[model samples]
Target: MTMAQARGTTDGWPDGTFRNPVLPGFHPDPSVCRVGDDYYLVCSSFEYFPGVPIFHSRDLVHWEQIGNVLDRPGQLTLPPSTASSGGVYAPTLRHHDGRFWLIVTNCADGGGNLLVTAEDPAGPWSDPVRLPGVPGIDPDLTWDDEGDCWCTYAGIEQVRIDPRTGRTIGEPRRLWSGAPGAQAPEAPHLYRVGGYWYLLIAEGGTERGHAVSVARATAPGGPYEPCPANPVLTHRGTNRPIQNTGHADLVEAADGSWWLVLLGVRPGGGTPGWHVLGRETFLAPVTWVDGWPVVGGVEPVMAAPPWPARPTPQPPARDDFDAVGLHPRWVSVRSRPAESWSTTERPGWLTLRARGASMDERDVTFLGRRQQHPSCRVRTLVDPAGGRGGLVVRLDERHHHGVEVGDGEARVLVRIGSVLATVATRAVPAGPVRLRVDVLAPAPGDWHPGKEPDVLRFGVESADGTFDVLAELDGRYLSTEVAGGFTGRVIGMYAATGSVHFDWFDYQPEDGDGDPTPRDGGAI
Candidate 1:
């Protein structure tokens, strides 16, 4: 975690701008909710699927997903995930009073937590009530301006809640107990304002003691208190290599300022733990001061803050997938079987029909996208016309990796979940097997190895040696913090519900100047 403290601060300010995970790839545990300049966010997609995506911002730094609240498959509970387990975890996008809700915790199967609505947050949302006896695992829902509505998860023996309506809630008192002080207590989040009732949570857990505390209690159950900076948004003692940082969510900005979306990365490298570019989406600049809430002002650096001036139309990163479904920022690891791939039967081409070749570890069907560059180049035209569709970067199903196509036989599979070591067979390029992969990193003062390799000290060592760094950028790059699941990034086209279907899927990302080049893959 050293290279002069992992470096990460945008320098002189202004290029693509600066700051903590302000929405990078595979966004995690974020939950913003503003509504005047219009903001709306949602994250935590565990087993991935079209679950809880829905983004849309006006100026909180260019975001635009706009749909996906469990897009199908009975509204979700997607199993078959490994890197960890099945779909939906830590979601809470509220609009309240007039309606907008979303409150999830579908850790897989209705063990509890689930509610949906839509006064429109770009959603048609509904279907998914199940809430009865809920307990923990990132829930969040606070109302009180007088409207009442509390619900913050992670149990000790219930924890403080009172929902009782949108499907039932109420009865939770276990109070505090977190940090290495363990005992669940994860991602709670509640915030009432002046009279106080903070709660907040995310205590010393997520990884390397992530921490983001607060306790306050005026009612809503509590003996609460803490927050004297009790591990506020931690690094344990600032050795800084960006290990975990507690799941969080709190938004104000529309003028009132206040921001803190949470989730950080840079653990090991090349494919371990965070899997480069995954646990993304960050931003901290909350300063309520005298009444609490204060971050990134006294220490804890990370940079990239100055993106607000004309962003309501930054769309067109190019997607000719033509849309009919999939795009609320697209996500999929489970819940995808309609035969796994299709497009209204195909029109201009985006037919990735690989019903069953390899989706990573515990059974996958990737449509992935979220490695965001330290060196990017992912060309794909595949026609697994001989079998097994291609092009992936998954980080689960054991520790996935990719580059495939199998019509006339061409491969490069790397699986680590159920272990596929590295296949490497090639031959399908007689026509359009295209395939191009790139992951370069290591450039700052240049020593060659990943200067910020999360904390493995260096990088590269994967025939199963187990070091796990995956993402740690801004110094010599290396960006890949993907995390067990809870999705984001979702690139386009797929097929193999049981067979082939890559008539076309041109993913683009290649400006590569490290040398030895051959650029011109399609789709912007």
Candidate 2:
């Protein structure tokens, strides 16, 4: 049986459970399509490879990572700066004429949105084709029963396209402007359910004022009328803590239940509210009441997850450095200067050779995904013959936490608002010492519970010195709510400046819990 067959049925979310965005932590601008009872969804990658992450869902609740839509350079390239928040934006995933299609905007070069598709999710995808003259952000496609396809985008414009050639079929038209059009409406999607064809859009830029609005009309091309309900979704009453709730893609479950997935950011930690893993993905329950869409725990239902228990289980996010290569989830924030990071160079460890002495704040590989979960401890064995290595929580080059074993001393870098201040440091013999980090994850519904404040800490254990707390992290001051980025917290390791190599890194999710593959390769 296939991955979808593993699940029994697809429908009826636990009313309130689908709250916020469905896919959380670093996945953003989601577009999902249903083929039979199986669901396939994709998200924009900006600078990360696998430009569009494709996921599979059966019940619309449980989701699995099927593969990436753009798997090769021929399809997409690793960007230097997709935009502080750009790169690949608003991707529309669809199935047309028996083939899979995904079109997106590559912002690194300010290139136009391009299209790529494959016979299967894990693809040898086709080369990207630049769209014909449509500009701005967020592009989506709608297919009618006649097999006619219409492309809707951020512009006040719509274009008909040839399903077979992936080219324009007719003159593009500037259709309807939503909510007086002043909302700077973007990320528009067109779909037909009943007698009414619905046009859903995101307006008010990507910040606290963001909203999901809708309109309806009799034809694909409109003189569309705004839904009677007006702004279907808003973050009005909620403070800036949950600010900026826009960019949405809606879907109908196999059981005819309606759901919408959008991109949202939670700013609560670090300076400027970090986007450690980048833009987070959210899903909200939506319903049509008198031809309008209502969002966020609409009456009988609760708010959606930044989309939730999709069709698949979260894949194994943990990895043992003992493996030959870095895990698939690992990404360098900026372009990697060198690929000398080879496991063969240092046996029994995934070694990352340090490069440029200082890196740009927005992009750095060391500033990896925020491990997502809270209360996790990561420890690594460093065979520092003469250089440096350590474990860290990286948001970018500027904001990061790590206990480094270098310069004959172990020091913890406390990142505070674009500055790295050595919070704690100690002298040790230092050659081949082990550095361990324990990051405290925030508990649900407990933002400021002091007894259990979401803080981070690090320690250095060595033959020369016993394990000692290098720094006691105070996280009450920061959160996704404060360090504003589009994603959740992820943690990893780093090597800086020169080519220093790292040894075994053991990530223990939930502090003190034994790591399944704790470093066995004793430190030199």
User: Pick by TM-score: which candidate is best?
Assistant: 2
Write candidate 2's Cα lDDT for 193-288 as tens digits.
787788888888666578888888888898788877767877755644444667778887767778877776655443334333345666667766
lDDT of 1 by residue, 1-524 (tens): 22212222223333444434446666777888887778888887776677777778665555767778778776775666323545577788878668888888876664568778888877677787766666656777777666667676775233333443554444566777754455346777777777987777776556555677777878756777777766667765554546567677777776676878788664433223233566776676778777888876322244444443444443344455666555555566665676656656665445554544456434455676555433454454555554566665555554545555555655555544344654445444544555545444333333323333321111122224432222211221222343344443344334443445444444443343132232222110
Query: lDDT score, residue 78, model 2?
Result: 53
Best by lDDT: 2
Worst 10 residues of 1 by lDDT: 454-463
- Compute each candidate's TM-score over C-alphas: 0.35, 0.80
Q: How many backbone clashes are present in model 2?
A: 75
lDDT (0 to 1) per candidate:
0.57, 0.63
Against the hidden true structure, what lDDT does model 1 obtain? 0.57
RMSD of each: 18.5, 6.6
Quote the lDDT for 507 in model 2.
Answer: 55
